[model samples]
Target: MARLRDLAKLIRTKNAGPFLLTLDIMFPDRRTYDRVVASGVIKKESMARFFSVDESKVRLFNYEPANAIKVTVPRLVTSGDPADTDLFGGQQFGPLVNVEVPDLPAA
Candidate 1:
């Protein structure tokens, strides 16, 4: 939890635009998972569904509940020519890069 908060602060300081953090957990008990979800520390859209195949093992996407974090940063786009403004109107645009961190166990 503390780590997550620190990460959030770091992200804010970086001033990166349009980022996503995904946390993945493996085979966690229902109660523990629910409690973590209830914390509201993660965004709703970042929550991934969980599937339990056995009492000891469960699988979920890299999301808050799963303990995996993903950070997405937009890529910089440059115009073909400095004098040509038609392509970008004197600006450049590009898509964002998706960064996926490894999974972490429940704390």
Candidate 2:
């Protein structure tokens, strides 16, 4: 398996709004990005499940030029809410760091 942690040079998250967060998965190069995309492991539905967010609230965007995927989802709790743990969602990308994506089997 080629885990996302291996293919991605960086995976990070930040506050998109008081109620939303943005995640960026950056690949080292276009080859790696293509491989990850072909692997079919990082779909929007999967991310919705992984992040415990409703699929309707998740948006996945691929930036081919940047070789990155940008995802936006509602924050687990509104940013700066009384119960919110992270104001900036700075640590939210941690869950994606170790996610595994199986590589295509050699023919």
Candidate 3:
């Protein structure tokens, strides 16, 4: 099974704001990006489950020009909150790294 880490050129997470964290998955090209999108492995519901956030709070954006998929979810605690270990949310993308992405359907 090809994992997300293997398919994406870059997978990163960062603080969107004090209350939100954003995950960016960028592919090397549109073909790769489309494969990931079509595979349906990176949707809002799955992301909500991965981050333990409410489904309504998860937002996904597909930018074909950039060959990227962006997902934003509410943080459990404020950015600087004592309970928040990831001040910059840079380490929050671990859950998605190994997500198994099935091969694209044969045309």
Best by lDDT: 3
Put down candidate 3 lDDT per residue, 33-74, tens digits, no spaces: 999999889999899999999999999999999999999999
Error of 3 at 67 (Å): 0.6
Task: Indicate which candidate wins on TM-score.
Answer: 3
Stretches of candidate 2 off by over 4 Å are: 105-107
Candidates 2 and 3 compared by lDDT, better number: 3
Please tell me which model should have the higher TM-score, number 1 or number 2: 2
Give the lDDT of residue 28 in candidate 1: 38
- Residues 3-85 of candidate 1 have per-residue lDDT tens digits of 33322212211212222121223223444334444554333333321111232222233354543433222222223345533
lDDT accuracy of residue 10 in candidate 2: 88
After superposition on all C-alphas, the RMSD of every candidate to the true structure, in Å, is 14.2, 1.3, 0.8
Q: Estimate each model's TM-score.
A: 0.23, 0.92, 0.96
lDDT of 2 at 20: 88
Which parts of model 1 have CA positions greater than 4 angstroms off?
A: 1-22, 44-107
Q: Candidate 3: global Cα-lDDT? A: 0.93
What is the C-alpha local distance difference test score of each model?
0.30, 0.87, 0.93
CA deviation > 4 Å runs, candidate 3 = none
